[model samples]
Structure formats: structure tokens, C-alpha cells
Target: PVAAASIGQVYKAVLRADASPTGERMTVAVKCQRPNILETVTLDLLTIRGVVDFFCTVPGEGNKKLRQDAQGLLAVLDLAATRFLEELDYLQEAANGARFEREMNAVPVMRDVVKVPSVLLDYSSRYVITQEWVEGVKLTDLEGDPKYANEEGAALRADVVRKLLNAYMVQFLETGFLHADPHPGNFLIQPDGRLCIMDYGMMTEILPDQRLAFVEYMAHLTAGQYSKTLDDLVTLGFVSEELAKDPAKREVVGPVLAQTLSALYAEGGGLDKKVEILDQQAQSRIGEIGDKLEELSKEYPITLPPYFILILRAFGTLEGLGLSTNSDFAILEECFPYIARRLLSDDSPRMRSALRTFIYGGGDRLNVAKVEDLTRGFGSFTNAMEAERKVAVTGEGSLAVRSSATPSGQLDAATKELLELMFAPEGNYVQELIIEEAVRAVDSLSRDALVQVWQRLPGAPPGAL
Candidate 1:
């Protein structure tokens, strides 16, 4: 046996040719469910329900009530219990793995680097799952192992981590089907240099509207609009409308959220600097951020929705990986390009609504600076993707040969898309805003300023201005 957990143990085995999916003898990993795990899980759940019932009905000192808290925790626990029970059925896990493989292959950026092992359904059962054996070290072990601690090793780890992060981004922003168990234990760095994602027992699906709300959440958070950030969270089913609308709770919760989330912006300048300022303000009187959160949970009823919990778990695990690999790694810096690409490229009406909200959420005024940032981010992301495609087509070993130059073809396509959006009937308001902003800029320029601009143009005649 190679690995054992609470519910299962994995063994190395050689499958017979008749049982193999390819009709050839091959080594495989057989994961067998623990004996009588269902009864054990049932007992544990019953005990938990009893405790939950007790707390929900019982009152504490000073007549402190816990019904609201218990109710919220119960909802999350029920969802978790359902997933855990599903894990006992190995066939369900196999189905989850197959679906994940299909989704990962659907993304061009991930198809080459990420993979899911194929399941041998003929050998698999409700109690046993058989999959093709893969040889590699756990991703966590690669960071500090002597064989992978040198310069080359560092480069490989960095590349692998970037690809892994991109895979998670695709799951969150595009696919909506996310692997909730994203810890280091579930990922292996194969000898052939591909990331093997294992253990699909705990997967979650986000509704399309929820995914769009999350995209908007990232946009608002990056812009340092905490109030709108709260609104996005509400739309995401994180915060109850009653709790979010309460003026007193907002006064306390807003700053705490800012402090916790701004930790992602601990690098770079400009917008990052602004985020740092907000963090500093929020941390003025903190005993500890965790303590504050605990106190808030006691003071208010904060529900942990299943999807929201899974999202946080995945992101937190990824952030931990980033920090372990590089002391100076900033999660937001690594994640913003993905968010920007989605914002610019996704043409669904919900996404278009999100983009408009991002631009005008602050007030009636047009946020020209925000629009400029979006375009710049999109261009950089497009250039990087183009470089990656070229490298993949050429069968290059790494990104060392990737070019730093912009790809004009992608930019031209983006420009065309923007033009179509601008002239479309639904975009009339945006068109008016753009023209008004342009005329305002020109009207504000002095004759001397106009002359300077004209003289700076290519092939301008001397004294033409």
C-alpha cells in the first residue's frame, strides 16, 4: 500500500490485460474504500447533529443565543456531509475525474501542462477505483528537495506553479466546475513535467451568475471600492442582505475585510500602494485579524455557503503554495492578468454588465483611468498568451526563449471587438461617454499645448503649429 487515509488506502497493482482499458497489461493504482466506512461516517454525523441541536436550542451565559450561528454552520455541514458520503462511492469519484479531464483539455493554456489520470472502469467498482499509475514526487516535496533546489529546479517549480495557478483561474472564471480539494497532497509533479491533479472526490459547481458575480468581486476589490466589494459578495451569496445592509455591522465588517484581503496586494506600487494604505488604516487597532473575525462572527450571523467555502479553501491553498515557493510572491499580482483577460474577452451579457458596473460603479462619472488599466492589462495578457502558443507549437522546453514584444495581431482583433461593442445599439451610452471625454480633453488643452502635441507628431513640419 502506498497511501492510507481515513476513508481509503491506495495500493500498487498490475492489472490483467482483459481488465485494462487499452486491452494491454499495465501498472495501476487501486484505491479501496475502508471497511464499513459508511457506518462510521453515519455515527459521526449523528453525533454532530446532536451537538448542533443542543447548541441551537440551548442558551448561554448572559442569554447569548446560538440558533443563528448553528443554522449557518448546519448548512455548510450538510453540504460537506453530502460530498463526503459521495466520496465513499468510488464510481462517482471516477466520473468526477473523467469530467475534470475533459474540462482541463478544453482550455488551450492548460491542455499541455495539466492532466488527470484515466480511470479503468472495468476494474473499478463502488468500493474500488483503478487508475493508470503515474510516477512523480508530491509538488510540496519538490520545493526543498536537494534534486530540485538548484537554479534549474527553481525555474521548473516556478513554471509549474504558474501553470497550476492558471488552471485554477480557468476553473473559477470559465469552467465553474472547481476541484475543492486543491491541497498540495492532491497534486503531483510528474517526471515528464506535467502536473497531475488527483483526488476529485470533493468537487463543486458554481452557477453561471455566481461566477459572473465573482469576476465583478475581483474587479471591485482591485479598484479599492470596499463598499461595492461588499455588494459583490452579497450577490455571490457570501453575506446575507440583512447583515450587509445593517449600517452598524458595515462599519465594523468593512475594515476587517479590507485588512484580510489587502494582504494579497503586498507588492508593487500605484494601486498596490493604495491598497497598502487601506490595509494600514484597517490595522490601526487590531489585536489580530483572526480575533477580529471571530469576534464579528459572534456579534453577527455570518453564513458560510458551500460554494463560498470551497472557493476560499482553493484560493487559500494556492496562496500558501505561492508564499512557500517565493517569499515575495503576491497573489493579486499573479491573479490580476487572468481576471483582466476574462473581463475583456468574455462577451456574455452578464460579463458585459459586470464590465459596465466596474467602470461606473463608483458614480455617474466615466472612469477613464479604470478603462485604461483594463486595456493595458488585456494587451499584456494577450501578448503572453501569444508567446506561450508559439513556444508550445515549436516544442520548446521552457519559456526562456519567449519574446517580450507585443503581438499586434491580437491587439487588432481586440480593437475590432471593442469597435463592435461601441457601435452596437446597447453601447450607445458608452459611445456618447467616449466622445464626450475626448472632446473635453481637447477643449481643455491650450493653444500652446496643442502646438506642442502637433510638433511631437511624426514628420511634423518645423513651425507648423
Candidate 2:
């Protein structure tokens, strides 16, 4: 079979003539597991558990208590990890794909904005999955392309981001089930400009209560309701009450939380700020806090429900993809509305109590006006596609030669800076820095210089050089 992914392989095949649904020849993409993937997954889980367990037990302030709490917490995590890993089963994947299609069909907006591959359930077997072949280019390839460098391009990119975020929010809050992976490679942009999303081996479902808690947490963050946000986080098991009550412990986490909230409000910022806060520097200082928490968890460790971890991982993947496309894409802004709605519409006693505290305690109100403004912005962005223009396909074997209006403007200064930073002798922090730099360099330098520089960069893909 042809390889399609890191953990699985895909093959292009024709359905048996007699078995054709339409009685016509059809191509299908078949995905199957790579040898030893199960083993690799098992080992990975073990490693994660061991590392988290050991870290929880490390001696430090409150570390002993955290260790005690972590023991039971670890057991719960292990159980969830096992369940998630079991989703790798071909049968489970098929069922999930069917459910996803049903969910997608229920949402009218999703029909236009997102593409869910048509699964060939009858053709699937114990170790294999068959789905319709989707023809398109990966979004990863479009990043920094001159074809997508203009105002229209930026708007299209932004629209796709918004649509994806909206879809996730609705799925998590309304349906409680979601596609857990949003990586670029799993996303395809058709020539006709439709967004095709494939690969559903890792779908997850959230419990209703947990989903409600998550929504409230999101609402609190978006509304700038810090104390409520903290309470919601604790309710969701992302943090513990002890941490919330202890000023010393809170002191350790307080600035990070403030920075995270501030970054959310900053123009052109998003989840990247949270990631930056979690980087090497923060990790070093906060490692002890985490250890202490884990130790404390051994006795009173907060057990995060399975769905919450899945949501966290899903968001993490989405944020990574956003950064990969453009360092400036803000995910939280796209996600705020559904969260706000969840909080405001909630009728549960916990939610009511939280809302009472939020309102009476002078918590910031959900900015309905801001949500309306953002929704308008998103609509404008989507409806504002650039006028159709042709580009010349250069070199021999070129199918056509055409010229349209030359695209205007140079690359942004920040883009240029990022490009230059990639060439630094010291290590660059982000992967693909060198590749991005090469693309920027080509835009800035002479053809010969561009070619020379491109040749020097290792792993410059075919069209890139």
C-alpha cells in the first residue's frame, strides 16, 4: 500500500467492478496501519505515564502531597489513554467516521465550509478503511505562496481558520463529539476552493457536564472574568481548589494566568501566547509546581475527565496548525462565542451559582457587541474573495502561459524578520523556520541569489527550490 501518514499508510485502488455503488469505475483511498504502530503507541503511553508520575513525586514545596494525589490520578489517565489508543481499531474508526458524517450533515453551515470524506463502510475490513479519493492541495503547501499573499488570500486563510474554529466549538458544546485532529496535512484545499478534511481515526466525545464546564471556562476567559475563569478551570479539573485557595501556589500560577489572559486580548494574538508561556523558561520554573500538584494528587489529585484531555489535545493540535500557517492567527477569538453562549444559556445549579458570583461580584459581562463585530468581520472576510486572476506555470511542459495583473506589495516586515532569523547559525526555535526563510528570501533577492540560497538550505522541497 502507498504510504499516506506517519502512523498509517494509504493506497489508491479501484473498487471491484461488480461491487461499484454507481456501477462506474471509482477510485478510493485505503488506509491501513503501519507495522508496529500498536507497539509504538503502547510504549509512548508508558513513557508519558512514567514521566508524569516521576515528576509528580519530585521533592519540592507540597510535592509530597501532590505525589499522594497523583497516584490515583495517574490510574485514571492510564485508563483514558488506553481507551484513546483503542480507537485505533479499524472498526471503531469506521463507526466514528459514520458518526462524524451524521454530525456534519446535521450542521448546514458545515456542509459549505468543511469537507468530510465519504467513507466506504461496506468495503472496510478488520485492518483497512476505504474512503472516497479527495483531490486537492494540502494547506501546508499554500503557506507563503504568492498566490495566497494578497489581501484576498489573507482573508481566505482567515475564513478557513474561523470556520474550522466554529465547527470545533459547535461540536464540543452542542454535540459533545468532535474530530480530534485538525492538522494541515489532513486538510485539503480543492482547486474549486472547498476545504476537504480527512482522517478520522481519533474522534472523541465529551460528557455533557464536562462540556458545560468547558464552555463556562471559555466564556470567563473571553469576558475577562479572571476569578470566575479560575473557578471554572478548577471545576473542570484543569486546576485544583487547593491551588486556587493557596496564595503562595496561586502566586506561582497567577502571573502566567494573567499573561495568558492579557495575550488573549492582545491584537493579532491567540493560543500561541499560551504556548509561549509554556515554553522552556516557564516549564523550568513551573516544573516544581506541577510536581507538587501531582504529589498532592496522590492523596487528593484532581482527576481530569477523559473528554477534557481530548479537548485539550484537540485544541493543542489546532493551535499548532494555526502557528504553522501564520504565526499571528488568533484561535481564542474564533472560539469565544460558543463559550460565551454556553455560560449565558446554562441552567444548571453550578452554572447558576457561577453566574450569580460572576454578576454580583462585578465580573465582566460577555461582550455580545464584540461577538457581533467579529462575526461580521468573518463574514466580510469570506465574502471578499479576490477577483479571478491567472498565473503563468513556468518552465518546459507548462500547460499554459497567461499573465494577469501583477500582485502588489512586498512581504511583511515580520515575515522578513522571521526569514532572516532562520539563517541564524544558532538553533531556531520553530521547525520549518529555514523553509519559511527561503520562501521569503526568494521574494526579496534576485533569481540567481534566490536559487543559490535555496540550494544551500537542506530539505528544500522540489517546487520550493
Best by lDDT: 1
Compare the candidates by TM-score and give the number of the best one: 1
User: Per-residue lDDT tens digits of candidate 2, residues 26-113?
Assistant: 8899988777787788888888899779866778876766665676568667767866576667777887887887887676445554
Q: What is the lDDT of residue 10 in candidate 1?
A: 96
Give each model a TM-score: 0.76, 0.63
lDDT of 1: 0.74
Report, for every candidate in turn, its global Cα lDDT versus the true structure.
Answer: 0.74, 0.61
lDDT at position 205, candidate 1 = 88
* lDDT accuracy of residue 439 in candidate 1: 81
Candidate 2 differs from the real structure by a C-alpha RMSD in angstroms, to one decimal, of: 20.0
For candidate 1, the 10 contiguous residues with the lowest summed lDDT are 397-406
